[model samples]
Target chain A: MTEPALGGGGLVDRHVAFVAALRGAGLPVSMAESLDATQAMAAVDLRSREQLRAAYAAAVVKRAAHRATFDRLFDLWWPPAIGDGEPIHDEGSPDAESLEEVEPADLDAIRKMLRDALRDVLLTGDDEALRRLARQAVSGLGRADNQPGRQSWFTYRVLRALSPETLMASLLEAVLAGEERGGLAEKVARQMLTERIRQFEEAVEAEVRRRLAEDRGVEAISKTAVKPLIEQVDFLRASRDEIAELRRKVYPLARRLATRLTAKRRLGRSGRLDVRRTVRASLSSGGVPLTTIHKPHKPHKPELVVLCDVSGSVAAFAHFTVLLAFALREQFAKVRVFAFVDTCDEVTSFFDHGDDVVDALARMSREADVVWFDGHSDYGHSFEVFNQKWSDAVTPKTSLLILGDARNNYRAQSVPALRSIARHARHAFWLNPEPKQYWGSGDSAATAYGDVIPMIECRNAGQLQEFVEAILPI
Target chain B: MPLFTSPDDVRTRLAATGYLADDAIATTVFLADALGKPLLVEGPAGTGKTELAKAVATAADAGLVRLQCYEGLDEARALYEWNYRKQLLRIQAAGDGQKWEETHDDIFSEEFLLPRPLLTAIRQSEPTVLLVDETDKADVEVEGLLLEVLSDFQVTVPELGTIVAIRKPFVVLTSNATRELSEALKRRCLFLHVDYPDAEREKAIVLSRVPEVPAALAEQLVRTVRTLRALELKKAPSIAESIDWARTLVALGLDTLDETVVAQTLGVVLKHASDHTRAAKELGLN
Candidate 1:
């Protein structure tokens, strides 16, 4: 009933209980570290939140192992008494003693429902049916419609939401079940599901590979053999600063073009001076004859042609780049957007003014001619198509932007086609959405492309912003 | 004074008229009494993280203070933004002659400073539950600011220096893992990962949250949600989704989840067309 003592000892008591609660909530908190945290708390001032958090974190969480868990518990246990009444401990409250027991039977039922629902989805190609089934399954288990049990059931939900494992597994189950189901409808569905799932899985794997490369770079920073920590230190600031600066650079370029056009408008290519703007400026200055004059501000409107690789490996990056192109429609006079896997398809007509970026990207992925992307990536075939059908689209004033990972799958790099296009274009810039470190590895044809045209790495949103600045005057 | 009775009696008084005692409720009570520090919970959507925050707030008999984080959120949002115009007017009204020497510091004083959620929580005298909702949605800078305030129960505004809390408020931060928080920020807090409760706990939550609904109907509702969470989809409905799904069924006067009723209410869960088609395929609706 007495007020809890607020001394050096109080800090230890708070953290000890916090760590214990963390352990109880299924986070890994060691006994040794718990003691260390308690000791450290007594030694340090608990008044500063930063100091206390660091001390507790240092004493308890090891590595990145339990960092996330520690963050959650700190918010709940310290300063804020969430999910509990009374800021201070109430020893007399018996409700604070034990945890309620988990029921295994309910969990099993939910698991079974998940399996059945997934099985139905794979067999029938019916998403609505699956949702209905899922709803029924969860409801039967004495839980709410969206809640799944902890443990494996939770895993099942994550797989469903984030990972395509469940859907792929279910599709496989359905395809296999076709032997018993019989006929052409089942056979066609199985074939379609198999092809789609394979493409999806490959795309996911490629993304994982990209992440692995980034992780490798981060790892190399600490090692004695590679770039040191100082080199890595300014990367966060450099990216933001560079993106901002790049936007500024484009503004001047656009202004110059706009001035030249306005000058031409007045002088009519006579190479003589036009005094209209000068006259207007002087009048505004009350006959003081101000030398500085105001000219028309016209935006630099260049012709743009974007060739994006819609191969499964680079599909995610391509979607975003294409969306950027659509968003940048205002600055360009004409924009030609093409998607290629093994062959190219001109999808310039798909974008309309004021179309939602997300909706457009989703539609492009669903409706774009995926024929060039079966299983293998063939840059040779793609380039051949570009030369044969879309050669006339490029012009002297056109800015050609090619976005891809540049993995040609050991096929011909088709440098001749790219060179031909570069001949007509003002500048041919290859924006590879892959790390510069991964430029030459494996099937990547980035090195070959880099030799012919200027290639810049465009990965993540920060890089995308930089790319936008480089291409368009904002 | 209340007599010491059975555990059920204590739970009933805590529940008060139709609420059921669940694991989260039990854990909150136990931890608040045992540890004396606030509990922070992180989880995927629909995992009862926010609900736990609310429940704890209710149990403590303290007012709940929430701060919702988002992109481009600045210090003025989480802490305080000064009433510059008012201060300027005050400076003007006090006459320019004596103001420079006597009231130079007064214009930028605490009177002109408006307290934000973080600062307000510190200043409030009554017990309060401060919920920093969706902390991950906030930028890394905001997260850093949060670490400074949550750890100390005080805010340091350069103009005002340090302002300590009269009473420490209960704190809970929830995240959906939008981005990785800095280790510096994470180090200052205890962490709890709340996933979707197991079927038993989920049942308890459903019943406790929606006691007016029939028990049979509640079980059916829980079972259906468990099943839906198994399929691959863009938007996996959360515990909130589950509650809505149950309510939808209850509104339709359906005792059980049938295929017909599900088709009619499919919009409540699967949002995307592809998601719907994919879910339907797996559930064998087509």
Candidate 2:
């Protein structure tokens, strides 16, 4: 495809350049967004500030988390006009601030001022002074204005001016480089960065604590057990020990359940005498009939293979279900575990005997992109990956347990993969973490998969355990 | 880096990023700090509650330790679990009665205590921000466990006794309010309910977050998301959703929040096929 000409009845190439620069300078701009920004620029006149503002807004950002970063990048991308960009008002300004104020720079003073300024702006909605202060603070970095590489220098200065983390990182790098100047520069820088980082962290922690403190309505998990006389289902809180005991008790029951479920036997008419069956058969046998005893049949436990999604939205549920599957490996002759976000990995090797399930999960999470967004959920790619690498593991005696939110993000659903796996497996069970009512909405392909096999709603541990009890056997 | 003089200064920051909320954001920020507790923000599905946690993390320059809570979360799952290998080795090496105290202590030691999100937050010496996310979906017992931890910053094990947090861990808990948390836990900390911001606030939020986003387009995007949120969607668009949606549109080279662009990028905000179908039908994208 031919490239669209710059400034030819479209957004100027400079605008795209500005976006690229913004992204390279640490702004999180996607390619799709760059295109949006370009188109937006074309729709609005650059000279008109209002129009320019509207176009930019339309092209980028959707959430509150990105506001400050976007604002900083925006200023850097489109520096204020000369008329609007009055020189820094502080004594620290490039042209006016004394070398003393700029030279023996108090990192703490700068940080405190920045924090107070930020909090003030957030509280009052006026940032003229803060902006001026930011500009002035940049001068203290000793960046020469009007140089060819001045943009990066300016960007760094601004980044340092705004973010205490950036400032601390830069200060540490400077100290490591052995910049011994201004007598106590090194000490001051270290102290300032440390204090600022601390304060910044406290600010964050405080916010979290506030949320945890709030009146979040809670509910009890219902139980099916009851006191002696009558059986009843009631809501109650189960202690950790209670849950553990349940796990221990249920495992044996699961084996018994397996035996009952597959309790079918055939006996031969000749062999060692069968006390019950042979005697009963002899009653129906001919006058001089001899009966043969046959070997009793026992149900073989089905092997299990679980494919779980650990993407940004579904990792929490996946963690629980995956751990449960790992714990129950003893019941089945062979059990395999796999985790996926946009792709799949068989992480069963991590869970050997005596392994801490939590540690194994944590290790896997650290190495894996549990929260990384692959732009889209490509079900096709995940299935293809599994088919190419792990399909052989599944057999006619194996049960496949698939768990996720199943929002495919409009990518290829790869229905054929599920079908193929289902065909080979003894039984296929799709467990959805979300409320059943939310099924069939948005980009979810659950219903599509539901067409192939029974998809059950498994929301809590009780339900999960019951499902396992019902299906984990032959 | 950008500078804001006050919380009000965040208005422009929010506007620049196409965010819509302007009302009581400072109140939310203040309660979080003044209470010396993490803020448990409850909101609708598509509002910016999660983004708020992320924003606070960014603004404060703290390490964001997030624990995405869900069903079947247990003590070992949420707080800590023993590292069996390490425990076994210690047990094997000791193999004697005189080392009883040492062996007992070894199991309860921080080394053996596999720090989940809960323990990790409490153990962090540095200024740490912990996000116990989506508390609604977690079982009531899990919430109770969270309450116990949040109230005292300690975990009690019969073998180890109670391990208290040496450093005060900043906690931020968010919920879609899918289910309510118990009153016992709520009474111990501060509460903030975040809702979708108004048009003006959203405009400001968007501008602040995505400065390169064209002003017209940003405003239009904010308006579009706001409109979508108002609609009867199975999954409403949150601030995070809007941000992703806008970013996706931008990446696709769309200048305006038109129906075509919305259709292509709908997956970001709406996860269900039916939700998309319903939204498209209602919004006239079809």
Candidate 3:
């Protein structure tokens, strides 16, 4: 809409691919945004990759939470292979690349030489040198295995080899070489030095991932390396960033799911007749019963009871499901969120303080009494605890949602306890984050639990979306 | 003429207004100008989302019309509303038995229409910057109203047909991400996320805004603010707050930011009592 494209077909192709990657990562980049991205790229200085990065980010990234994912994917796609056109390809073996840096030195000799060079670069704050050192460091130390088709690359080994912490002593000595032991300059220098070191650590991580991505293709590496699009990411395996992203999308997801539920429970409500309008119409009809006028009807909403297993691997899943349910609380008459480990406790009070879900979740873990006897999940004990504590929470008007994997930790199964609770509620369903095939595995009572309530696989947000439609209406 | 010719042009112009635009900001601003589209700027509070709009308005030497959104904001407050009292008085005075249809048309004319910020921006012949500030705070219904006016650069008054823009004002909408704005609204604009500047850019901002402060002191202040930001506080000190801190240091004639100075002037950068305590505890000031 702005102007015709200025770049060649190559740039347009790259942009389309990048946009596809972004969309697959769960960013809602629309047609107009993609067009704006193309137009934005045409307007910016293409020679500078940072400028191009900013342009694409401005055009595509809608939320702050998605920016980290965008940046990671952007690096993989458009990589800063700038100035130094392409990375040096190893001739003989992948491990032979670092040997080119020195005369076939041993591990200790390489560390000593690399450390000396790193200290100088870090002291001078040279970014280019740091990146170069990152490549060398990864090639030298980041080899976890030599197996083909397996991504054995790890950032930890490289960081461990560099041991940037050991370099900190010398760094502080140089920055505070002649100055007082502790002064304003020292405080400032320490903070700056700490950040620089962290950046170096990130550089090593990025280098390792990039090399892995280059070797095994971006799509394959992205499965293990990059955080998948928020919806496709398993709740059990989601990173902190993905969980935060899920939290941000919870409301919009709720709105979409609510629209779906509205279509299913489209009950026409007949409101109270307006007496003034009805009587005025009756006077025209010789004081007899005639036309009617009704006030706007208030539709009866459902109440929600979320019994979440806030323990072990299922914590993220339970938290997100509870958050999604509570986001739709306006559509519900009441929302009561319960948390359980070995026992049960009502954690609904944690969510009462406005929409600060992060703070509420933090407080729920710290303050809520969800643990009793060894913190191991006991499904039977928790059900009995819930029955004893809040049996009245599940009424005929309520929709009961049990969020757990039903692993049961090889403990006793309380099918009767869950069955009684399910019978009380208008609609009851169990959301197991584990896959369907893993239901009857060792230590997992999911198959047994499925007998009492319909256990559905909700491993990811996409599956949860379907389960949400199933459990919303009576 | 376009507001900006290129991304560099945006940087140069915005810098002159004492607002530094990084590559992303410069590129996004220029695109927003060249495309004649609204710019949706979202970020954490105090990252200078609002300041970007003001800087553009300053750079273009145009009028800045801000529609400060909040709960209970209605069409009468946002778009054009009829002057009901003036219309009623006109009806009472014209008791000479004018036709009802003629009176009805007369009451709804442009003469009785009161243009709010949105309409005011549209009707201006001169260049204007329409800032829909903290848009997420407003009810979702208001977005529907914004969609019609923004998409066509026109407003429909039933009394009078559609009123198109004499000159399309540069639109900038800022959000703190309290809620997600609909995709339809996001689609119409260029999206930009403004985050905290790096240490170097922040120092430049401090020196540009407060030229009175020494460069070394400005560096120290930016470093301290960055450290404070790293701490988990309820509200972090924004770029504007850092500038204010610089001005404070200059006023106090401080050459260096030692522990003594920072502890004493902590309140200058931190407002919340709890935040002060947290910062003090974290920095080991106590």
Interface RMSD of each: 16.0, 27.6, 7.3
Q: In candidate 2 chain B, what residue range of length 10 has the lowest lDDT sum? A: B1-10
- DockQ of structure 1: 0.04
Model 3 chain A: worst 10 consecutive residues (lDDT sum): A1-10
By TM-score rank, best first, the candidates go 3, 1, 2
* Model 2 chain A lDDT-worst window of ten: A217-226
lDDT of 2 by residue, A13-122 (tens): 54665565545434456666566555545544355443454345434543223343444444433433221134333324442333235334475665455555444433
Ranking by DockQ: 3, 1, 2
**Model 2 DockQ, alpha carbons vs. true complex:** 0.01
Best by lDDT: 3
Better of 2 and 3 by DockQ: 3
Root-mean-square deviation per candidate: 16.1, 27.5, 7.5
Deviation (Å) of B103 in candidate 1: 6.6
lDDT of 3 at A377: 91
Across B1-286, the per-residue lDDT of candidate 1 in tens digits comes to 1111322342454566333444333433333323324445666677767766676567556788888988657798888988766876777788856748567688787788887888888888887878888876666668778877776777888877888888877777777654545656555555555666655556776777665678877765665566666444445667777777777777777776555666677778766775676556555554
Q: Write the per-residue lDDT of candidate 1 for residues A1-474, one digit (tens) a residue.
A: 111321123544655666666665455566654765675455344544444565566456533335545554564345322122222434334322211122445565445545555555545545334333333332233222343442111223323433335465556554545454433234334444554444333333322222222333312211221211111212223343343333222323333333333333444323333477667766654555646444444445888899988766666567656655655565688888988878788877666643334445557666867356564677667777887888888888798988888898888888887777678888788878777999989999988878888998876544665466655642
True contacts kept of each: 0.00, 0.00, 0.47
Q: Judged by DockQ cut-offs, is candidate 2 incorrect, acceptable, medium or high?
A: incorrect
